[model samples]
Target chain A: MKYNVTITIALKEGMLNPEARAIQHALANLGFPTESLSTARLFKITLDATDAAAARETAGQMCERLLANPVIHNYTIEVE
Target chain B: MKYNVTITIALKEGMLNPEARAIQHALANLGFPTESLSTARLFKITLDATDAAAARETAGQMCERLLANPVIHNYTIEVE
Candidate 1:
């Protein structure tokens, strides 16, 4: 079966995110009273798997091995 | 008031996505029978706005002007 998967990766809470800060500053400069900003990365993958369970397991392993940095990132995988 | 916004940016349908292709190939090579993959960029922003309506408008404009490329990318904004 073919599975559609989505992985959302984000920095762990309390981690300093300079990119978000820069975006907030940019918004402020653009006349938007921005106080703060946070950013996340989303990846969508379609693959052939035996079942939804297998797809989820594979995707979670992918996140652990490559897609997310365990030290600073947290990721969630959804399979359909 | 403070508004939390999420902007999801993605390549328009039918566009060639080399990054997705690369990820698919990587997954296939990793012993996952990946047939295809799609990717999207998600940005989370927290800002100060007058109200939800204003926040939505500002975020939509931001996506239009800076966050997303109109020709090749489509974006959606959600304000909370």
Candidate 2:
């Protein structure tokens, strides 16, 4: 099935550089722009996985590993 | 421009009857199921308005008039 995974994350309030902050911070510290930066929650990411479980797992991994901070960022996933 | 107004509202965390609660309440009290309802935030409401200003205005009215409760439900409008 074609699973639609939409991830929405708001910049932690009071954090400067929502659009470029993360990228620039990474660049300044690590000397490179992290590839996972996104504009806002208005993102639509599509994945064709075998089933809902697999899709959810993939999304969860992405969120935990790269996309969001488990401490401050919370996410809701819908598998359709 | 073809304006795309997507409204997403979550059931208040403590409120019961998310899917049928609002409808049932309206039905029990007002004697009919209210027409305005939705399943989570997976809503895509499309409108072809004349301009961005008009589209924003229309969306604002809809939020204030029906779709969301200003106190709890917040909305983001995108025009494309």
Candidate 3:
């Protein structure tokens, strides 16, 4: 079977998001009132697996091994 | 009122995602069988907006003006 998996990787709390800061500054300058902004990386993977459970496990492994930096990031996996 | 808004920016179809390609290569090298891989940027914004509709509008504007490059990227907005 084939499953479509989505892994959303986000920075752990308290980690500085310089890109978000830059974007906030730009948005403020553009007259958009933004209180705070944070950013993350989302990965969509389509792979063949035995089942949804297998796909989720593989996706999680992928996140830990390559998709996300465990020290500074956390990830969530969704299978469809 | 304070609203939490998320803006997901992704490369439009036909655009090359070198980063995804690199990740895919690394995954394959690691023995993970991946059919296809894609990546996107996800922005989480907390801001003051009159309503959900207003927040969505502001988030969309942010995507258009800065968060995404219209020529090569597309974005989706969610407000909570």
lDDT of 1 by residue, B13-32 (tens): 99999988887777677776
lDDT of 2 at B41: 44
**For model 1, what is the C-alpha lDDT against the true structure?**
0.84
**Candidate 3 TM-score, true structure as reference:** 0.95
TM-score of chain B of each: 0.93, 0.52, 0.95
TM-score of 1: 0.89
Better of 2 and 3 by lDDT: 3
- Candidate 3 chain B, run of 10 with poorest lDDT: B58-67
Query: Which number leads on DockQ?
Result: 3
What is the full ranking by DockQ, best candidate first? 3, 1, 2
**Which residue pairs collide, candidate 1?**
none
* Better by lDDT, candidate 2 or 1: 1
The residue-by-residue lDDT of candidate 1 on A27-54, one tens digit each, is 6777765656788888888877889998
Please tell me which predicted candidate would have the highest TM-score against the true structure: 3
Model 2, B1-80: lDDT tens digits are 56665555555545553544543354335332222323344234455567878877766665565556777665666555
- Write one digit per residue (lDDT tens) for candidate 3, span B1-80: 99999888999999999999999999999889899999999989999988999899988888888778999998888888
Interface RMSD of each: 1.6, 17.7, 0.9
* Better by DockQ, candidate 2 or 1: 1
